[model samples]
Target: MSQLRRILVDAFETEVALRRVFLWLPAAAGAGVVSYMAADREPSLWLLVPLTAAFAGLAFLARGRRLAFFLLCGLCAFFAGDLSAAWRSARVAAPIIDRTTIGVVEGFIEQMDFRRAGARFVLRVHAIEGLAAAATPYRVRLSIHRAPPFEAGAYVRLKARLLPPAHASLPGGYDFAKDAWFARIGGVGNALGRIETAAPPAPPGLALRTMMALDRGRNALARRIDQIVGGDAGAIAAAMVTGKRDLLSDAAKDVIREAGIFHIITISGVQMTLVAAIFFVGFRRLLALSPTLALRYPIKKWSAALAMAGAVFYDVATGSRVGTERALFMTLIMLGAVLLDRQALTMRNLAFAALIVILTEPESIMGASFQLSFAAVAALVAVYEARMAAAAADREDGLILRARAVEGERLRLFWRACKNLLARGPGGLLFATFCATAATASFMAYNFHELSPYVLIGNPLTLTVIEVFAVPGALIGTLLYPLGLDAWVWRYVGLGIDGIMWAAAEIGRLPGATLHLPAFAPWSIIFLTLAMLCSVLWRTAVFRAMALPLAVIGVWGALCGPSFDMAVAPNGEAAAFRGQDGRLAVIASRPSLFASEQWLRADADGRPAREAVKKDACDKVGCVGYLADGRSLSLVFDKAAFAEDCGRADIIVTPLFAPAGCAAGLVIDRDELKETGAITLLFTASGVARRAARTPDEDRPWSPAPRRKWGPSSRPFAASRPTRAASSDLDPSSVARAAGEAPGSVEDEDGDASPLE
Candidate 1:
């Protein structure tokens, strides 16, 4: 077993690899970022800053001993990462919109992202009608549904409905508001009617002007590609060249997603590597034609430099997303290695790129893009390194003719070499596919709640087309566009796009193509990540031994964690209760489409929102539903139903105020939810447990406490009716029974202070 493991797991270690201590810096720094994110409250920099500096200085001083130096350096990286995240959070802090508002909006369009059905515009806001100057947001994003989409740098005035950034739909769900805070977006909304262009209050600044000009140029190219392709094929072709996926048809998107080869359209490692490779080889050959010049100067370094420039150009032309930037940085590092005559394709280069990305964008560590990209690369490199060390693989590649061989023997050798080539053709591609898919499956499931079983069929088919024609076509088209001769290039590229789309559609339609998964505990991914790194990074027996157990623990936790019995939206706009069939059935007076969708996906339920509604006893005043554990839940809309619900139900939830002394086992009201944010309840043999999306206990900047109502104060009014029960009228025995405790069973040291039940 150990011998088999050693062959497959790359235990071939070099002294150089073992001594590269900086390889671990990115991991340590990432750990620090995670620690900061998981904290319930903000960290104090004044207390942490000096301590971090001192620890780093200590690491610097411990240079003589290699082991101690590595340990201390790792600690320093961790501390620096934590401090970096905190500092970034503080620096990006800005005013957030408090409530929904409907009015005219005037702003300069900073960005425009078009979709097939609609477009989203990010604006640098100048004013919102009727809002106080202090309350105006610095920026807002609006979904434009009407025609005549505005371009970047255009000033527009339009009426719209704007809302504050929202919290998670349920506990441990994705937090859009937190992401928006980092992006410096204060609000999001939908625009109404046609957009009206207006004169700018002032000219755009030099930096903004430059960026907008570049965006306009790229968008023009994307549009031209779309025009030539003329269908869903065109949309995909445009995306392949420009990374603008908004124009994709729904069918195309579904097929690509199910096929699990959507990364081809995105500006990721594959795209970057192709562009750089083309430029590097093309320029090197071009330079080498002049032997006199080639011998006098370093043509390889010159090629690498041009390759780096080409990569940077591709990155910016394709929107410069965080994932693309990461790819560009890694590509640049590899090219730089060529210049220095060092081994370019190694783990050390990957580590250096990761470290640079972490220090520059610490917040990016939390994003799915960063995690997925890095994970796939790490797995591929590990497998490649392992294969390189195998003796058989070398012997197969070393097959050649000997000078002493006779005619018949030479013929035999030629056929033998042909057989080896045929055997390697499909085997190598399949192996690489397995390695990348296995490494990214858990994270993909965790993020999208779905997996593609046909990726094995899909990746090989689509990737070939992408490599042979699609990428090269885009590259040629982009380079020749300024000459007005690129239309022919795009027409050929469309044929490759058609092939890819056909493969995606057919493979995606196969039975069991997509598998839905329930959301797992967030910490499970951490364990899984550690397992991957341990198995791939080090060639030692001890590290290899640690990998399997950690992976098992992660998979167990992800698959076996407790599920929510019931859930309520943050603002009490939508609520859901789980039925006996283990499916969520929503119950709400004013339903929220976004919240319902999130809940269904998280629960791994594929039913539509309408079909998923709970068929409970309901009327205008209230509704009653039953839990799997035989508990009755009552939702009261009117104050009239509260009196009856508070008495008969196991739990009472209402927007109206319930009178004191209700005998229900639990009471959840609007005021309570306002403080708790969204919450999920878990019912067990012992009792009921609640998990809130955001509790009063946590004080993160993105999730500030609810603000008080604004306006002039009013005098309190007294109710004349005396029929309802008042405060301090509770019956001790009834309340105790509701709490599942005998009345006055326990004694306290002070008789006057029996703990309030």
Candidate 2:
């Protein structure tokens, strides 16, 4: 306790900017968490407005109490802002509830994603054939079996079957609906036939027109690059330049992901920083060629301004995604600091940039891109700051001169050799790559449930080529496009990119390149993140010790084994049970690739859908099998099958109604599944423990409980009695009464489970 106090006192005295930045971070993070948790509910502005005003007033009155009052006010204001933003987004993109109808849909193409099977795109709906304006969704995603000639901002009409955006495939899986809500996508469907052009390119407003122009430019650039280098390498090059990744094949993507260098394809902080640095250095050197300009003008500031403008243009030209926006904001803040003659890479600058991003798009905080990008930057900055401080202290103490004199010319020569070796050789590059990979590994594992061990070797190998040749060549080619001199540059860039791809492929094929990990519980990620923040934010050596225990606990929690024995889909059509060897064995009567992938990924199983399914037995109704624990489980789709399996199986899963006298220890019929959503079961020595997707407390706008309109019917037959069933039929009432209990009722229900479910 005394050590902690001394460390805190030392930090407070030495680091004002770090202290202020840390003070603001928790408030912003708290607001983001609240916004995410309350995503299913509508926020009330009436209450928010007064709360914000009162907090502001209190903050003003308590200005002298800097630590307490300012932090409280910041928290209140950000909380209100986040709540308001989410509410407005929800109100604007209300889901289309009536999903049974199929009709002609007309909209403008906003985004396109090409898949191996075909192409998928998000359409900004302008009209629907039979639905009124108010009833129609603002946007719908459509998948076509064949690639279309359409591009972004093109108006088109097509006959399609539209439904509400999909729910999570399994309990605690990815929430496509929530993501779609933020993206303003209300419906998803598949096109029935060819898409027909509806109208000429006529965007609604100036902003949209500008966006369309940028899209057109990007498409043009992509096509030119593809023509220059026609293959997977070409596709990856185009994505790196224009942020269009749909052209890359799944195999290509997997290779890059396994190599842990996929971030290169995304136009994030690394790309933006490279672009700005290139421009800054190029312009500064060019201006410095003239002594008059160098002496008379603030050439450094001018270079920074130009770099900022270039970064902004690059961001817009590349679709301005959440990651790009965050990078752009951070770049702008740093450049602005340069213009103002202030420190650029301070913790204060990062904090300000974060505040701006959070205020503008609070939902971004929930994304993996945001988390990973910020974590990398914070780690780099902390390391750089510590190095700079140490260097300054060494210079102040005259240690360098004294050492040089004492060691003489031999030592000086050795020092010079080492300096050159580090600066121009692999040593410095390897060190930097190691630091970056180490900093981002935990975040990647937390978000993706996988880590690439080869990143240590692969990133340095590929990234060196990218930084030296590919990025520069691409940027130069882009600049030379208007002059019709881009082809040669693009060819050179393609050669470098091809080299990167080759390196990634070779590295990815090595043994144990990728390691799949089980999903971490939410609290584990929270604790790990806090620990990272503590380690980076504090300067005192003693204070850094605060993160050690928290980090250990977080890692322990994340590495814990899977809790549930079996998982069932929302519709009871698919299920996965863990075998004795801890491998997931899928039993899906009606196979869905998306659901199957989710189940396998969550189970940390790397096998394909067909290979993952261990028990595929089925007879007319549904499948029946024994779990690893020897527990009998059956899925009955037909009445006769239900009657036969009822008493024989310990657990029965059915899409149809269950008989009243069904004697299964646990029964999940369509009715029970409708209310509970997806379910997971853990078979302990005592009994079975169940986890539901949606609980009673989860009754919000996004996940409303199933409405029960009818009263419960009494048992039609006498209890403790059985009736003879026909060979082809089963009496539900008789079965219910014979069991002497309700059909769906089961004892030893466990409601408190992992929040992941």
Model 2, 379-441: lDDT tens digits are: 777767876785577455455666566655556556755765674467766666666666677
Write out the backbone clash pairs for model 1.
Answer: none
Count clashing residue pairs in model 1. Answer: 0
Ten residues in a row with the worst lDDT in model 1?
A: 748-757
Q: What is each predicted model's overall lDDT from 0 to 1?
A: 0.74, 0.70
> Candidate 1 residues 1-757, lDDT tens each?
9987765444433433565346678899999888888788888999669868888888889888656777888888888889888988888887777766788999888777676666777788888998887878888877766435558888899997777676777787767677777777777777877678999888878988877777677678888999988798888888888887778875676779888887767777877888899999999999999999799999999999999999998888788877787789889999999999988888887888888888777788887788888888888887777766654664654464455556766776677678657546887777778888888888888776778888888888767877887779988898899998999999998988788888888887789888878888878888888888887777666556778999998998789754788887765545788877767877766455557767887887755555776545567766777887677878766665554666577766665444456656776665566567778888766666777887566778888765544541211111121233432455544433333311110111111111000
C-alpha lDDT (0 to 100) for residue 27 of candidate 2: 42
- Give the TM-score of each candidate: 0.84, 0.86
Judge candidate 1 against the unseen true structure and give its global Cα lDDT, from 0 to 1. 0.74
Instruction: Give model 1's TM-score versus the native structure.
Output: 0.84
For lDDT, the strongest prediction is 1
Off by over 4 Å in 2: 1-7, 17-27, 38-43, 70-74, 77-92, 97-100, 200-203, 285-295, 399-426, 482-484, 579-582, 613-625, 632-649, 654-663, 710-729, 732-757
Instruction: Look at candidate 2 and tell me the lDDT of residue 15.
Output: 53
